[model samples]
Target: LPPTGPVRPDSYDFSFDSYFSGIGGSGFFLGDPKLLAPASTAPTGAPFGARIASAVENAREGIADHIRSSIGGSEGEIAAALIVGVRAGIPEAINESMRRTGIYHIISISGLHMALVAGTIMFLLRGAFALFPDFSSRRPVKKYAAAIALASIAAYLVISGIVVAAERSFIMLAVMLVAVLFDRAALTMRNLAISAIAVILVSPHEVVGPSFQMSFAATAALVGAYAGFADYRAGKTTAPPVKRSFLKFLSRKLAVGVGGAAVTSLIAGSATLLFAIWHFQRVSPLSLLANLAVMPIVSLIVMPFAVLSALAMPFGFDGPFLYVMGKGLTAMIAISAWISDRSPVDAVGLISIQSVLLATIALVIA
Candidate 1:
C-alpha cells in the first residue's frame, strides 16, 4: 500500500468489506484519504459521469440552500431530507426523536418517496392528456403517463445518487410502470419478489443491511396480509354499487381514508418490529399511532409541496412552497416530540437470536 496510516483492516466492518470484495472491489484504499476544498462546479474538462455527478450535487446544494433561507432550522433540514433525499444537516436530537417515534424513514428516500413522486407525475400527466379528449379517448393515455412517470422517477434516482434503498424503490416503481404498460396489476407480491431479487443480485450485501431487511420485510408482510384478506374485501365490495347522497359519499370516503391509514400503519409497524428490535435494541410501542398521525400530512402536504418547491426553485418561486413544507414538518416534529416524551418507557432490550429464529418460523407458517 502507498503512504498509508497503520494497517486498519480490523477497523473496517468485515461484512461490508466482504461484500465489496465479492463485487471485485478493494475494501481498503492504498493511500491516506485526502481532505479537499469544496468546488462549486464540475472540474475543467471532466468526464461525462463526473459532469453529471457535479450537476446533481449542484442541484441538491441549491435545494439545501433554498431550504436554509426559507425554512432555516431543523425543520429546513427535514425539508431537505424529504425533498432531496439528503440528511446531512439534521440535528442529532431531532434524529433520535424521529427514530423513537418511528418516523425516521421519512427522512430517507424509501418507497414512500418513490410512490409519491411517481403517483404525482402519473396523475398530472394523465390529467394533462385528458384535456385533449379526442386524443385521450383514442390513445392509451394512462400507459403513456406511466411511461413518463417512470422516466421522471429514473431522473430522480440519478439525482438521489442511486443509494441502495432508492435503488430498491426504483426497481419496484419500474416494475409497476411496466405492469401498467402491459395492463397488469402493479402492486402485487410478484412485483415485490422481482424487485427484491433484482436488489439482491445487484448488491447482495444489502440484504443484510437494515434498509433492505426492514423495507422488504415490511413490504412482504403487507402484501401477504392483503392477499390473505383479498377475498373477504372483494366479497364485501361486490354490493357497493348503491347510489349515495354527496354527504354519505364524503363520509364513506373519509372513513376509508382513516381506516386505510390505520391499517397501513399497523401492518408496516408490526412487520418491521423484529428488525427494529434486533437493530436498534428497542421498539417504538406507539409507532402505529405516530405514523397515522404524521404520515398523511407528510404524504399529502409535505412531499407534494417539497417537489413543487424544488421544481420552482430555478424560477425563484420556491419560497412559499418551502414554507408550507416546513409547517408540515414542524407539525411532524411536534408529534414525534410528544410521542417520545409520553412513551419514554416504550423502549425494550434487543431480542435474542433464538427468539428471532422461532418467530421467523412462526411467521412463515402463518
Candidate 2:
C-alpha cells in the first residue's frame, strides 16, 4: 500500500504483486505495493471550460447554501437535491424511504424537473409578451420564449452537474425547442429517437448504466402510450357536447388531472420495473399509490415554487417561495415515509440477462 502523506500535485508510479481471487470473483488483488513519485506544481490557470465549470459549481453551491439557510434540515437537503442534483447531504434513511416508495426519481433531477422549469419559463414569458397585444401579434413570441427556455435548460444542465438523466432530458428538450423554432412537431417518436441517438453518440458507456436505460425506457413508454392515446382520440367520431355546467367542467378537469397522474405513474413504473429490480433489487408495491398522492404536491406546489424561488433569489425575495416549497417537500416526505413503511418485501433471486433483453425487445415492439 502507498504510504499516507500530505496531498500533493505530483504524479506517482506504483509497483505491486498481483494474485487471482477464488472462483466467482473477478479482478486481481494487488499485494506488497510500492509507490514512486515525482513532485510537480499545480497549474496556475485553468482552461476556459474548467473556469466555466468552476463558476457553475460555485453557483450550484451558493444555491444549495441559500436553500439550507432558508429551509434547513431534511427539507433543505431535499430542496437542494430537487433543484441542483446535490444529494450528498440527504440522510441515508430519507433516501431509503424515497427509494422504497418508488419516488426516488423525484430527487434525481430528470425530465420532469427540466420540463417544469422550461415550461414555467415559457409560460411566464409568453404571458408577459401577451400583455402587449400589438407586439405579441407582430412577433413570434412563442418561438422567442422557446429560445429563452432552451437557454435556461442549458444553464440548468450545467448547474445540475449534467448527469446521464439530465443530459438525456436536455437533449430531448433542446430538440423540442428547436422543433418549435422550425414550426415542426416537437413531441414525437422521431424526436425521441434523435435524442436517444445523440445521447448514445456522446456517452456510449452510459447506455449500459441504469440511469440511461431506465430514463430512456420510461420516456419511450410514456411517449408511446400518449401517442397511441392521441391516435385513439383522433379516431373518435362522437360529437362534442354543446353545453356543460361549470361544476361539471371543473370536476371533469380534476378527474383528468388525477387520472393522468395515476396513469403516468403506472406506465413509468412498469416500464422501469425491470431495470429498477435488476439494479437495486427492490420492488415498490405501493409506488402507484405513493406517486398518486405525492406527484400533485410535487407538480403543483413543490416545482412551481422551486422555479419561483430560483427567480426570486437574485432579488433576495426567495425566502417566502422557498418556505412554500419546503412545505410541499415536507408533505411529500411524509407521504413517502408512510407508503414505504407499508411496502411489501422486495422480490428475491436474480433475473437472467436474457430476460432483461427480452423485455427490452418487447418494450420496443410495443
Candidate that would win on lDDT: 2
Q: Write the per-residue lDDT of candidate 1 for residues 4-80, one digit (tens) a residue.
A: 22233322144453445454333577888686987888989999989888989898778677787789888988877
| Model 1: how far residue 257 lies from native, Å | 0.8
Q: Rate residue 49 of model 1 by lDDT.
A: 88
Candidate 1: C-alpha RMSD to true structure equals 4.9
lDDT of 1: 0.81
Output the worst ten-in-a-row residue range by lDDT, candidate 1.
3-12
Summed over model 2, clashes come to 0
